[model samples]
Target: MADYLGMLKGEQLVSLSENFDYVTATADFVGLKLFPAVKTDNMKLAIAQLTKGGKIPVMALVHALDTEARIGDRPNYETMNVELMLIKEKLNQGEAIRKLIRDTGMKETESEILKAVFNDANNLISRVLTRVEGM
Candidate 1:
C-alpha cells in the first residue's frame, strides 16, 4: 500500500459531495474527463454512500490534466492518475471511503460528473457472477 498522498501546499484536495449526488441521483448523468474538478470529494463520498446501500456505483470523471497549471501557473503538469489509481486500489481493498480521501492528492473542482449508473450496473453483474461461480 504505497502512500499516494502528494505534497500539499495549501488545502489541496476538494470535496464534491452535494453536487455529485444531485447530478447522479436526479439527472442520471456521468462525468467526462475534462469536466470541472470542483466538488470531487463530494462526488466520491456520494458514490461511497451508495455502495454502503449495496449498490456499487461508477464515477465517470477523469483525472484533470491541468491541475498543476491552475495550482502554480506552471506548464508541464502531471495529471491525477496516480492518485486516482490509489483511490481505486483502496476501493478494491475494502478500505473505508474516508481512508481513500486521506491518502490522495488534490482533485479538480469544476469537473463534470458523468453518469456512473451503467458502469456500476456492469460491475455488479461481474461481481455477482464471480460469487456465483465460487459457490
Candidate 2:
C-alpha cells in the first residue's frame, strides 16, 4: 500500500491484509475517495497492532481522509470497486465465522452473523449476477 499510497523516501509503509473481516467490518462506515477515478462510499480502514500483530483481535479505525499533507502521485491514484468488494466481504466472512465455530470448539448459539454480513449485498450482487454467473 505504500506504493499505492506513493510514499517515497520514508521507512513507513502500508500493506493491505487478506483478512475480509477488516473489509467486511468497514462496510458499515464511510470512506472518502480522494481520487476522482474511484467510486464508493464509506471509506474502509483496517488496522492491527503491529506490537502484537498476530496475538489479538484485529483493530481498525477509519474516520478521516486527510492526506493533503503527504506528498506523492496521489492525484493519479487508482481505486477498487466497492461493489465487488461486498461480495468478497460477505462470502469470506461467512466462511471464516463458520470455520471459527467449527474448529475453535466454541459453543454455537443463535448466529445471525451470516445474515448480517450479507445484509446489504443483495443489490450489489444482483446488479451483475448474470454477467458473473454466466446465466
Best candidate according to lDDT: 2
RMSD of each: 27.7, 24.7
Q: What overall lDDT, based on C-alpha atoms, would model 2 receive against the true structure?
A: 0.36
Q: How well is each residue in 1-135 modelled by candidate 1, as lDDT tens digits? A: 123223232232233222333233323222322332343543222121222323444344555776543232223333332232112211232344324344542244112111222134345444543443343
Cα lDDT tens digits, model 2, 61-125, are: 44457644433221223343432333232233445655554565433522343233334345344
Give the range of the ten consecutive residues with the poorest summed lDDT in model 1.
Answer: 109-118
* Candidate 2 wrong stretches, greater than 4 Å: 1-95, 103-109, 117-123, 126-135
Provide the TM-score for each candidate, comma-separated.
0.18, 0.18
Query: What is the Cα-based lDDT of residue 13 in candidate 2?
Result: 19
lDDT of 1: 0.32
